[model samples]
Target: MSEKKKSLKITDAEWEVMRVAWTTKATTSKEVTAALNEKTEWKSTTVKTLLSRLVDKGMLGTKRTGNKFIYFPLVEERSSIEILSQELLTKVCSKKVGKVLESIINDSLLSVDDITRLETLLKEKQKTAVKEVPCNCIPGQCQCHLVS
Candidate 1:
């Protein structure tokens, strides 16, 4: 898949449609619309529009099943989240990653088990953490040059 496909930008409405497709495996536009209608005030046409946009964005794959089109997610939820997380990190200074992580941990309501899992992940990541993280900035976008 292309990088653009890997990191497809999803809107809130598109996410709602993707969630239905992901959970249901392969579903029709009517099914997606009905599922979303239970929780949202959106009309069937609005849901259909979101589904079409998702397919166009390469986030959803479509196949004709008789008179209806079945929709399935081309991108898994976990993969999409990972791409979004990496993109978010790219906007911030590498040196502030730890601080950002600390802020996230402090601001969120994590259970004891979640905290333990995070600690384990952190330990594993520390094994691969380099002493110096090289800046990938073009020129004046960040303060990496000012530091040295």
Candidate 2:
């Protein structure tokens, strides 16, 4: 299977429509509208507008089912999350990565098993990078404590 990538910017309304598409793949406009109407206060016309925008942005694909158009997500949620993560990292100072990670680790309600898995991953990464890696942050900006 070919992995086609597209840079589609998601808006709030578009995100709502995408949630429905992700749950029910190859869904019709009527199905999406019904789902949104049942779940949110958005009108059918608003959902239709979002659907058309998504199709125009190439984030969604359409196929004819008789006289109706069925919409399928061209981009998966995981891929979009990965892209957003990278974008966030790029925007943040390199020195802050360590401090940010530390905060996240401390603040998150991770289970014991999750902590164990994170430790295992850290050990693997430590083994791979024997030497200290350079900061991804701007000079003098990174607060990353990369060294053990």
Return the top candidate by TM-score. 1
lDDT of 1 by residue, 1-148 (tens): 1133245478867877877888998998888878888789788788889888988888889999788888888888888778777766666777777778899889999999999999999999999999987766656867787776
Backbone collision count in every prediction? 0, 6
Predicted candidate 2 versus true structure: per-residue lDDT over 9-64, tens digit per residue: 77867988888898997798788888888668777778889999999988899988
| lDDT score, candidate 1, position 98 | 76
Q: RMSD for each model, in Å, please?
A: 3.6, 6.0
lDDT of 1: 0.80
How does model 1 score by TM-score?
A: 0.77
